[model samples]
Target: MSSKAKLKAPVAAKKPVELIKHADVRVDPYFWLKERDSEEVLKYLQEENAYNEQMTEHTKVLQENLFQEMKGRIKEDDSSVPYKKNGYWYITRYEVGKNYPIYSRKKETLVTAEEIMFDCNVEAKGFEYFKMAGISVSPDNKLVAYGIDTVSRRNYTIRIKNLETGEIYPETIENTTGGCTWASDSKTLFYTRKDEETLRSDTVFRHQLGTPSTTDVEIYKEEDDTFNVFVYKTKSEKYIVIGSMSTLTSEYRILEADNPKGDFRVFQERIRGVEYGIAHYDTRFFILTNIDGATNFKLMETPEAHTESSYWKDLIPHREDTLIEDVDIFKEYLVISERNNGLNKINIKRWDGTEDYYLPFDNETYTAYVSTNPEFDTTILRYSYNSLITPNSVIDFDMKTKQKEVKKEQEVLDPNFSKDNYHSERVWATAKDGTKIPISLVYRKDLQRDGTNPLLQYGYGSYGSTIDPYFSSVRLSLLDRGFIYAIAHIRGSEYLGREWYEQGKLLQKMNTFTDFIDCSKYLIAEKYTSNQHLYAMGGSAGGLLMGAVMNMAPELYNGVVAAVPFVDVVTTMLDESIPLTTGEYDEWGNPNESEYYFYMKQYSPYDQVKPQQYPNILITTGYHDSQVQYWEPAKWVAKLRELKTDTNLLLFHTNMDAGHGGASGRFDALKEVAEEYAFLLDLEGIKG
Candidate 1:
């Protein structure tokens, strides 16, 4: 053939390397510690000691650089926006950006700031404690209930604050407390507390406001030893709903709030193959469920009796390829957030069952929280939107008038910032079994589309999680430096609906790993990036994804950072003594059983590490981590050192204080991110 003709001919794609069978995979005793004699391995853990010194220097530099860069950018606004509630306005702002401060907005005039409430930082002694995940406000807006962490990473204490008078009532509880609710009369506050030893056990407590008693009345206690319980009170303040969870799923029950302390009746029986979320509407309970194994859900309402036999009505029927995210009941309508065609839209449906209206925003905008005041017939929708080059914009939308207002627009660094500088596209790749997986790519537009760019891919495909489009200031730093950032929407995540999540979890869990590999390959084949310059990162369960991908296709990535990873799956799954393991048996099959154990052993990162080529890795953990303990990553690194063929660096850094999350403050968090990015930059040979 002529030289010109030969050059014009297309080249065939490379085939994926077949996975080694579990029985055939070999282990190397000195895989990671080849440099050390067995005697040296026991002699002060030299590798670990070196890693600690390196990490200390790395963290110190990262903290200094991040603080210098972000000090001027930290918004310190003393002005408090007036929020009118129950005939009065409350001004809320942060004091010194360290504690939640008090500012009152009255009659459009700013009142003198007073210390009406104390934040967790003030209540807890130390730099480690973080505030509770959620907060509640009383109907009359007089009492505010919030939770605080006391036992480092294990326990939470619910505290009540009287807004009228700057006083904190009932300082703490010994157990883990959450889900705070206030009665309509505002005389009593309700919250849920649980024992740290029993993962699934919890009890609901009611404490009368203004009382100095150190004890609380127990309204309800979950009796089942095998089931976990969660409780929430309706916004109407009429009923309390309790959700009971077994290894597989959960069941919801409802109780009357008139007595405020009574037995709850089973509102919905434990339906097999369904997940439910409960909301209240018009003095009735509306439960959203994915019954019959359909990934999309339908709304079922109990308008009268709090039992399965009660008159059941369907508010919204399930539709294929569409999933409802959240539903808010307004005065005469219901606003539902639904995801379809890879975009999220808000649909307002009349209570009379007619579709009133639909509002759609750019898919890149992430609507994190929605709030509505039915009394004023107004709604406040909070959202943040950004892209590869854009920083972020936090906007507020008025639902009734369909008008949008900018609340807090994230300041872009410079006029040089432009989305045209970078491009983002969504593509799909087929996994090992022909399952189509979605992947999002963001890269510099000027870079050659010849698979030569340095790429950093991320994924978290578990727990029905959806990694939607959201802006990251730190990520912009990578994009500006010509690094491609991609997200693999693998199975075990609800990104593509329920079936996508189900297909990726449990015995079918290997799909998450294979899907990530396929995405990496697709990026190279499609000329988006090259395998030589590729890096991967994930944390928590996502960290497990990172470990799996590294083991299955080590050649695909040059660097991997697994933070607080669930690496020792087999050991963790079988050990009931660890926190959250027993409760997570449903998500990951119980390893106590032979079948489950065998399935988990097949892909457990720490168990599967063999003497083969591997990539540079940085594994991080927290000493006080309750979810995934420090021993997991520590032991995984130890085992990897014994087995890996490649001499690539493997570093482990354990946070002395903190839980599953490694950082405690904003600066601390930024420093952690900067350090991780520094490692990636160092591997990619990109000088910061």
Candidate 2:
């Protein structure tokens, strides 16, 4: 603990900048941090990094121990379950010492010699930050296309490797979406490209083999700044799709894969507020849409040739209680992923209307979803299933016989770990508005309800994204060490239904902050943990949750970890050049309008910082984060340091080489988690 006094936290020099929106004026003192490469900004960040090192120096050994403990539980030399696609069985395996996966495939049978398609470990050798994505093989199986991002900005370089010749093509397409969809001809490939500055995916280009990327044809372009464009092939592999989507609407274009050069016709034209996604079956397309007042979404079908909003006929009519998250179509069965009562369920129906049943889940808070089922005629359905106390498992179910078999369950290498040693359950906490929020709890089986134990509560309630209760090996580290971990299934997510999301967005955004605070209060009242022992952690938008909660109820927790937080809400939304500003206008109202401007300033963390007490805080950011610029967190910590009354520990750390995700390597990212764990445990007087 003496190390905490060795260095003072960095104080950013202020240069007030005035921001005016809709005739409303506000001044930001730490706005100079927005200069990505300014010397002053770099110096400030470096000083903060040095300060963090000095403050955490006492826990360095403890951090390493936690890292090694978690690392020990991972089966480093592991391989994914092989799935049959086209004519090959694809398996992504990791060598004992490598940080990346090795993609390989075998023809016809597992006994055959494997072909090494792409060795990501070798490709990622010298780069400080490296990520490989979108491994797609040609339909003919002679070529492999993949995207690699070396700078950690998410803009990938599309490369082609000839499996037969073991040579990478001389031509490389840069600044793509890290995905490539191949045509049926195998010679042509399509990928989405991003703008140079805004980094929005706006164009889809078609590249033919043996030709320079400079000659690639622009197949489509989305002129709308709010919408992003991406290209993919349908599950049927019959057609390539170009989708343009914004916050509240979407439109799609389709071209037959066999006709690579054919014009892509609009499957559905954009409507003001309608959003829909399509799945291809025999001769029709199933449309999942939020059309006609379907708050929980609905499904409709239309003839493939008559693909239009006006031609869609009702298939599964809108249900107010059920949200259709995804769909998988097969020759004789339709598998639907639905969420009802905040639980995930899969509905399987025979095409002949003979049988319709839901796949059962015994755990109240487990996450289950359809896995890779590439074949259109297969009767076997593969799905992923897991809960807070269960290891991740891949289950294969036979639709005809309703037989289930476990293909694999993640292995925790530690012999002391057991599912019987832990306990998990679902509970409801009433918010201030009488809304019952679901919270998933997991802890050691011997946990005592004496309110003396340490608890870490996590939440993310934005973007209509549900924070499901899933198993994590790293979580075991805390659970084993007398920590109760809970996930607050708050609003701003489609957990209960679409209405849950609607109630926490735009004008109602404060509900999200209030809900998290209410959950914490409930836990404290129920004797789970007290204000002196509770810890909070969340990332990105959830980090915004942490900032807002700390402002609203500072004494509720002992420490808070905000990673890559988006806290400078007002200024960020005012600038459309930021990565997601324009697209998120509907989610977070446009601040250019006076009504939204004043509403945003109320809860915007940077603007709301006051001369008050705050719990121990650790904020981490990445220099190249594309989603929320690093300056958001940089300015947030600065303002908090300047205004907060209490002399509580406040630290900031920035990853100099990485982006939003923190670290590129699997093991390297665990180090960041270990550091946060050490921070929390150190505050609780549990130093290794």
Candidate 3:
């Protein structure tokens, strides 16, 4: 990159605005940036982008090289492992030069002729950003209903097409959630619609083929702003289920798939703090829920006729250390996905209790989860496995024979790529509260323990989402460049169990930030990397983590990257109009209350910006991001530029054509990764 030292940062004009909530007064100088599409906001964003471009001009070739290096590792002409569903084998493949996937299917046998359902490359020709979701084929396999989003804002337009005639129906449904569930007759489908303003999926609609979407009947509407509703057909293909859920509770309604025009009856009323998920198996429904204070969740089964909690009987009791994640029911076997301590475990049990066993996985830090097993009568169960140093492998295990076959393993095409060249391990860091936080690390075998090597730490602790140690081809660029990569499995995520997540959210949110800081300190103390060479990165909620960490311990890192970050916590939570605000109150406490307002104000990234020296920071956001609005990062950068004492590089880049995810194309997205890596590498004066 150019001598960033010579470049001047863009100055965003101050337009102070006072926001009062819960008797608290706050002055925001750059709140004007939140005015979407306004001339002033547009100009300021453009100027910042221009500044970012100029500052990193010298890294143009390096960026391209990194992009190509990462792209080279991917098998360009590759097809996913075909899985059978509803008498057809569905396959998703990509051409050598195409940036999109081509969806196709075959008849009962693999030798049958292939029928191309959707070639996204052709559909994406005119749009800078395009996404296709919810490709649901009719029960008879004659018609397909899908949702298309050209603007990348998560709002889709649903359309239907006849597979045999290759003609699209005239009806187009707008503002949908991009997935539809087909009924037995193949003429009726159920889809969820989003509220135009808040973008919340709040209503489910039933659409009849050959009819206008305007005339479609509303099946159900979620009255609570905190909840969202979705419709889906069970794997058993007998029931169409409508699920309404929030951060803490869930409710479901079911109707026979054969009775498309029938009224759906509630299976179980939603109770506060009681979350449950149902799976159909012949005469019973298997539920995974945290009922009766089972915080880690348990598996229960009840007759299809008696689908209330009162009739529910425990099939697999909850254990304090193990969290039952999900279940897949088969005719002869029952599969349970669980997490114990910090690792994923898959347990298989026979229906008659003849055989019960857990799939054995031997790795210090790896991820394993059930893949597609849509057919209920099949004895084979498919699951995926991968680790920091291992490529993903799709394995199929026969429940009856107790045997497994490797269906397909992800191919890393880079000639120099070899799993043996890298080493991965799990280590624990002690937190301030005497909690042990797990850190997963991967590095070259010839690494030195002397703190001179550059290190990049990554973390995202929010929403009870577990960030497992999965392999990434793009990450190889950093490892090859003499950098040590670490993933901090801190609090706010269900890495250990549900309790781990509970201890890190709401009032206990500070634990997430402190756990990360403690992990950094442990790495430095162990001589893995010094403070001068240490760096951090995260995106979205993790981006929130990056913001909080830099404010809490800026001196511990040489640089940081926050992507589509949710930094304005207090201001966002106070406004229920924002897309995710209402739904996330249970995750991040509602700021309307004085208790939460004061607590959130303490750590909200934008609120905590002060006149302090910070590490070189890079912030990225998308203009059309409906989840984490683009203005969060824009206002944050403006505030940091005004308050930070050091002249360290602080760059912001906004993708004009994309949403929370920067770019739509596979190769195009790598360019963003290249830009991020180039920024970190350029700071260390490392160039190829």
By summed lDDT, which 10 consecutive residues of candidate 2 come out lowest? 1-10
Between candidates 2 and 3, the lDDT winner: 3
lDDT score, candidate 3: 0.95
lDDT by residue for model 3 (118-176), tens: 99999999999999999999989899999999999999999999999999999999999
TM-score of each: 0.86, 0.99, 0.99
User: Which scores higher on lDDT, 1 or 3?
Assistant: 3
Q: List the residue pairs that clash in candidate 1.
A: 30-642, 31-641, 31-642, 31-643, 31-644, 32-641, 32-642, 33-641, 91-103
**Number of backbone-clashing residue pairs for each candidate, in the order shown:** 9, 0, 1
Please say which candidate is ahead in TM-score: 1 or 3.
3
Please provide, for model 1 over 175-247, each residue's C-alpha lDDT reduced to its tens digit, 9 standing for 90 to 100. Answer: 6555576666677666667766644446777777766426788766777554677677765556777777765
Query: Residues 1-688, candidate 2, lDDT per residue (tens digit)?
Result: 4556655778899899988767777889999999989999999999999999888888999999999999999999999989999989999999886788888999989999999888888888889999999988999999989999988789899999999999998999999988999999999999999998889999999999999999999999899888999999999999999999998899999999999999999998999889999999889999999988887889999999999888999889899789999999988999999999999999999989999999988888799999999988889999999999899999889999999999999999999999999999999999999999999999998999888889999998998999999999998989998999999998999899899999989999999999999999999999999999999999999999999999999999999999999999989998888888888898999988888889999999999999999999999999999988989999999999999999889999999999999899889999999999999999999876
Candidates in descending lDDT order = 3, 2, 1
RMSD of each: 8.4, 1.0, 0.9
Candidate 1 is scored at a TM of 0.86
Model 2, C-alpha of 546: deviation from truth (Å): 0.6
Worst 10 residues of 3 by lDDT: 1-10
